[model samples]
Target: MNHPATPQEQDYPLSAVPLEARKSLASMGLVLLGFTFFTATMWAGGSVGTAFDFQTMLLVLLIGNLLLGTYAAILAFIAARTGLNTALMSRFAFGQVGSKLSDFILGFTQIGWYAWGTATMAILLVKMTGLSQAWEMPLMVVFGFGFCISAFIGYRGLEWLSRFAVPAMIILIAVSMTIATNDGGGLAGLSAIVPSEDMSMAAAITLVFGTFVSGGTQATNWTRFARSGKAAVVATLAAFFIGNGLMTLVGAFGALVYQQADIVDILVAQGLATLGILMLFLNLWTTQDNTVYNFAVAGCNMFRTRRRKLVTVVGAGVGTLLAVLGMYEWLIPFLILLGTFIPPVGGVIMANYFVAWRARYPDLETASLPAFNLPGLAAYGLGSLAAYTSPWIAPVVGVVAAALAFALIHVATVAVKERRAEMMKPV
Candidate 1:
């Protein structure tokens, strides 16, 4: 691992964040809230909202977000204690050479998100304002690179943007929801709405959990800066559980009342088209930068470089190219893949930290790790298999399967070593 040479690289792509660099609870919370306040999440919520009655939708939201928050909070706690992000932590669980697998998977997902967001921003802007369709690609290129500006500057830039953007977005969402409730004739009206679409409870939970599980997996990037373990856990729960839940609720509300899942579309229908445009920009920008930032962090680990700013620019370009190539149309399938594959990485890391490492990872600078940790990789494979075959809560199944598999392997290996030692004694 190379030492970070610039202030921007102090995000420590290849190393642990030092104590002096840790951030306050508020800072971590705000940045995470910004990440969770995403448009896609609302779209996911809308899918659930249209399928179930209001009361059932709320129950599904609570269960799904609580599970997502718990998963993210556990990883955040490890990150804060170890001062390492998911990619860096993977070195211990996946081994020196094998960690790159996680790097590529995590990095690829973030780039996919970046491209989707870039395309979304461009397409939506053109449709909402009646711009010529020809301008969409050029706008994708522009916003693709533009959103990474703060990411290029690193954590300070992210925190600064979130400080302003999060509060503003929250206020806008609240205002929209209030208007929606009034138009729908309040609580009785909301309760009176019947399900218009058919979906199983399992599918609804999968939609809610799968929508952001990939992003949640990498949230350690921000939470790793927490000043304490408690700070990390609290901030993570607040963002994933409360902030994300609110986004889902807002989307569900809009879908039920206005028949529009996207808050932007709902706003436009409400004669707030101007504010809708503003909300779209802020909503996508907040998540776009964070997504690109996550890609850079994984890029640094994958390439073993400390130049995060360079990686950020390069990632934005790749994402832009993907957007131009039609990444926007791939959302549903992409999400299914994310739900099936991404959670196992987090599962392996949790098992590596608690069971294998006994809650302590050695300093990366001097640790003697193997080229590949066979058990971890095997566990990940088994976990992915379970997730793919499972009918209910695929993400949760993947996580538990991976963790349990790793622990089982650890026990078997220990027993083998003990047996060999016994046979060799006094011989």
Candidate 2:
């Protein structure tokens, strides 16, 4: 297994992982753990904790992460087998030009997240330093550019940042939990407490699952290097189930005990400022790098070019501008209103690989693809609609609906084509 990615290879995001370049499970696990362990996960957990009882929130997170892990694992397995990233794989189901739509979806969402995350860190940093509001814009620029430098360096930088940040996050959360527990009257008190507000079980599940569905859909960007399908599965499972779940627990713990959701804020409240600053930087930096890196991958694929570094710079500039303009508020409502749209992409890709194409992609060097794969596009639409209107689990419904719709449409359309050709034969 290739342990470290080549510098030249990381610069170009248009190609699939070569046969000799697959990586070991340990490497992939650590890399993804760095990504899955995020501040946003903890923030979502705070909302979860305030909405439900201790036991209920625990159950919701456990079930939600498992569901999230399942689809991510599917994408990871395909990536390991085909050595293609999600944006590239979308071409199989979405057609050559049509796949650009996927590129825009993935790229735009990541850019949105990048802007929101950078601004969030800036606001928090200003508050943490007790600085005046004037420092916020300066800090936002400083942090945004500083983080994009790592992204400009590409995957190696992300892996390095992840390796250190993942463990640091664990230590910070452990210490933060210990302080919060002692000051808030311990386990008995936490268990005895009630939710501050009412939240439906369905809504809680949606929040937990929807928070990361966009990123999870692009798991192949990180998992394409896995040495085998086993490596991909284990990496995805550990990252999603354990790393993600831990984030929620950390958030819930702080929110329930101290009414604070942001872990940095929780630590700062407990007089852990120095450590909070460190944890806060590492947490936001790793996520920002991953977000921007994925955005670059999508951008390069959309343009069918190898100039990912140029794309990286462009993406960072746009995201930084959006951040300064306060796009987070706009993204929040859009993210929820269109939450079901992203999950179907994973579903369509999975359906195309596992069922339609029999788990294999064509030669990346020369493959003639359709101009538009209507079956897949239609299936994605249906799946997203099901998610939006259904009373059941939205993400789950979206995935199943899209997968089934693609398979059915592909089979039926092929059969009709064959029959028409047979009837139109020279008689």
Candidate 3:
């Protein structure tokens, strides 16, 4: 397959992607597809299945995905317009040095997720193959490093894998979904079925939103490669709304019918042993590849180094250790917390890019930025607090609160700067 040339170390963390290196719409779409078609998402679907009636489940999924998709689309637009990854763009709002905080949050979260995915894959492998328990750690290492190498290759590797894996995954997932649907007695039967567990509508929405909010916020990492804004929007919409939505529905379908949320579990229960293994492998690989890539990008930003490949390797090491420690079982609560805190970063980015900078950034190569950006800092803090305390939709509250806080703080800063300039001129 044709690919972009390897990015040199000098250009790894700081520079905008050169226009010539931008990707076509189809390629970007495929990459996003690889990300959204994750086993974790299907697992989240299982959460959906236990909770609500069919109509409620569908409503929750649609509303939740719409929120996730809309948030991601805004980030995608800025990324395409600026050709900057989320970490780089964050420097605009968070300051050159202060951006490290955002980097830490994003990078650390991705590593945690990588660990969770690795653990999940390892256990699933052992279960499916009936391998000895002794092999689980070794399997985790193998899968972790395997996915790590793909990210080490950077965007080109993602493209190659997505090109092959995305299509294959779609077919395999379709088969699973169809089998589950048929077993549950088709569309009519699914609707008529009663829910086994009582899940509040708010909780269901939170489940869907929490599943991908962090990933969605970091979308600029991939969308920055899009050739145009339209491509970025289209790719994000297709992946977050359509691809991620399907994942939730399939999980819900299984839950409502078979009382299973995991697509792998559903597949195994359905007697599609071979297909189950294939889906499990592909699903984990696609998600972990992107997760590692996210970690590498954030690591590069945090350390202010261009050693992306080295960072990728280190991240794999850390994630593998966590997986061996059984992080998968304990990471769900952390992920939900992540959903609340992460959206505020997106809101801050939106305000900084659209309202403050008005879609233009001074040349980052030589542009002067503050040591810190207090407005962004304040907004993020307040947003997090509101999410924790408010009874409303936490993701929405966090995002809207942050955006408004940034805007207000920005206006105040500009006013103060203007007054100082006027006084100096008169004197």
Candidate 4:
């Protein structure tokens, strides 16, 4: 049996959550991840692939599905067993000071994504309402207000939103699929359409990978609530392979069948406007909520404060202001740039959790925060530089470059530390 809590334990208050709550939270994680996959993959696969042919588009889906699913599984396993968010877990690898840098960057970026998502959802709602496109202001107000209300209710409310959003996405996709197949002469016609000559294998791969790179960072947030590492791995793989993979395939198929690259326009053309609006609404909401929640947790951890609710509200407010200013309209270029930065950070975290600090400190599992590790910082910097400089690699080039840089840096650090200790020994 576990020992009674010591003062240290009592003061730190590790997540001694009930089993039921853990299960619920895990379910929420799965749903939220699934919803994110649906939103991002559909948008990318449908719209971005317009320039490509059917075969090239399918290839992109294949590469992205495999890479994201595999990476997420590995990260989820670490998160479930450790029960630590990305920032907290980073201390084991990145040192306390180093972790702060990464977390701050991640938190700020997520804030931008949250605001952008809200605005995009608002725009889609306006379009669906058949109101004048000029109603963007009113739509922005409605979305911002609704998001603030939901954020006020906190994590539990976010979980409820996930539950509703996931099913709504499924139904919308199903309805869209049905409409597309019926209208486009089914799969036979879709298969016959060749893509443009400009479409290449590389572009497809990049598009698919780009869609889920940001999501990889959130693995720890969800996995920490899982019942076990096994559960985390299973949930991550299932959600990505089945949920994400299928959605992208559907989007690709929709693009082929309709010869319409824009996902929103495809829905309108198919007379599935109602379902389209619902998809747009739920997709944006679920992702935005997750982003905001993650940002709040990061803020609370960084400031050593207990103002999660307040911070979330403030973050949401900032995001809303950006949305109203029409920043979301330029989300594509921004996300592309953001994507370049994501892989390196994710690589640093993954290397720290699974390699450098793995079981070296048994007490780490229950520790609230560990001392900052400098090696983690070196690895992150090297990785980021590689991603920024590499021109040939577009979509996932950063992820690969960063992973390699982290592993090399970590090994060198360990070697130097060993040499120093040996030199200082008194024989």
C-alpha TM-score for every candidate: 0.97, 0.95, 0.95, 0.87
Q: lDDT by residue for model 4 over 284-362, one digit each (tens)?
A: 7777766777777677667765566677787788788888888766655665666667667777767766666663334
lDDT of 2 at 217: 84
lDDT of each: 0.90, 0.82, 0.84, 0.67
Q: Check candidate 3 and list the clashing pairs.
A: 46-261
Give residue 85's error in model 2 in angstroms.
Answer: 0.5
Question: How does model 4 fare in lDDT?
Answer: 0.67
- Once superposed on the true structure, which residue ranges of model 4 sit more than 4 Å away at CA? 1-21, 24-26, 196-199, 360-372, 391-396
Least well predicted 10-residue stretch by lDDT in candidate 1: 1-10
Clashing pairs in 4: 53-195, 94-373, 95-372, 95-373, 96-372
Query: Per lDDT, what order, best first?
Result: 1, 3, 2, 4
Off by over 4 Å in 3: 1-7, 420-427
How well does candidate 2 score on lDDT at residue 93? 87
Candidate 3 residue-wise lDDT, 17-136, digit = tens = 778778888888888989998888877878888777778888999999998999999999999998888898888889988889899999888898899999988888888888998999
Q: CA shift at 210, candidate 2, in angstroms? A: 1.1
- By summed lDDT, the worst window of 10 consecutive residues in model 4 runs over 8-17
Candidate no. 4 TM-score: 0.87
**Per-prediction CA RMSD (Å):** 1.4, 2.5, 2.7, 3.9
